[model samples]
Target: MITGVYSMTLCDIGNTSFHFLENEHQFKVSVEDTIEHLNLKEPIYYISVNKDGEKKLLRKFPNAINIEDKIVLKSNYATTLGVDRALGCYGYSDAIIVDFGSAITVDIIAHNNHLGGFILPGVEKLKEIYPNISQKLTFDYIEKINLHTIPTTTNEAISYAINAMIVEPIKINYQRYNLPLIITGEHGKKFLNYFNNVFYEPNLIFKNMKLLLEMEK
Candidate 1:
């Protein structure tokens, strides 16, 4: 147990941001800011995809537990499997996890065995590419999109295409696996209406961190 802090800070360091949750409060801080601002004396539990950022975090909090080293994944996952994906699927029965962030991940876990997954470019990346590919296809609007119908404009087309791309693969996986679907990540809830069988658990990764702490004791 940490000597001074009342609760542990759990961080999920991704490609673009560092997400922190302590007790019930959560916030997103830049990796650099987190390294500079986080209290070094407090206990920290973190899972990271960025090696250099992880090193920075470790340097600041030498006692912090890297969640990757502590959690045991019972599966055939390669070394490249992300800790975020693992954390999202942990402590579940039979489930398929779809995380929509910098990149989209759809992973399966059954009977505690992480059964491999697929990765695709995220919607933001597609939006970036679509503009460069064709100036005529550009959509300058930044309004909330509803993907319930066919597109009549460039913005809607882009929204429709990316959402369809994300949804179709997930549908295929769900049909094949026939398991409960768990969706988590920055954009998980936005696609909730499109997916009928999905359970949106925004705090999955943090819950995984908590479970790790409990198991360690």
Candidate 2:
């Protein structure tokens, strides 16, 4: 339902990076970079889960607006839920939203009402676990995982375990809810092989941001 040209810039600030959408072009800036050096001319409407980054960005961009309050959606989630997770549920009446970032967040929305969901360690974090247990256990994740075949080697075992850890819970939830599965974030597309009725939207947050901005008008 949102129509017309969107000339404004939108940002989603996280702990490690600043994700930006300008005239449909998306890019990221590292948190270590100086914000003022970017010399952005336009006003940026943003949402932030990173408190320190939010403060720094606000000081650098006087015209920047935080649109967190403008994102009003039906939910029964606790007050402590991350803004990113809440926004993922936007425009979805019944679905499971899985965001694969530094941490994977799974949120459920049923009949336009957000039910509470769970979080799991992401691929990077899961990779870290084996190394901590033993030096020999350290191994990179495989590109392709065959769930049906039993793992024979150490690498295969680790790979299968990692995939199962991430995928099984989602499968259980999908079976319980029987709703469309929505996947987003950095590793969203990689998960498409595991589910049948799954959708991958890398710019989900940005899409929701645009919709929220339109509602503000």
For every candidate, C-alpha RMSD to the true structure in Å: 2.8, 1.9
Model 1: per-residue Cα lDDT over 1-217, one tens digit each:
5466457688898998888887778988776564566653357888899887888778877887886877777878888888888778778768998888899999988888888999989878877888798788788643346656778888787877887888888988888889998888888787887777679988888888898778877
TM-score of 2: 0.95
TM of each candidate vs. truth: 0.88, 0.95
lDDT, model 1, position 108 = 89
* Candidate 1 structure, TM-score to reference: 0.88
Task: Using lDDT, give the best candidate's number.
Answer: 2
Which regions in candidate 1 have their CA more than 4 angstroms from the true location?
1-6, 32-34, 140-148
Clashing pairs in 1: none
Query: What's the count of clashing pairs in each model shown?
Result: 0, 0
Q: Name the 10 consecutive residues with the lowest summed lDDT in model 1.
A: 140-149
Name every residue pair that clashes in candidate 2: none
Residue 187: error of model 2 in Å?
A: 1.0
Worst 10 residues of 2 by lDDT: 34-43
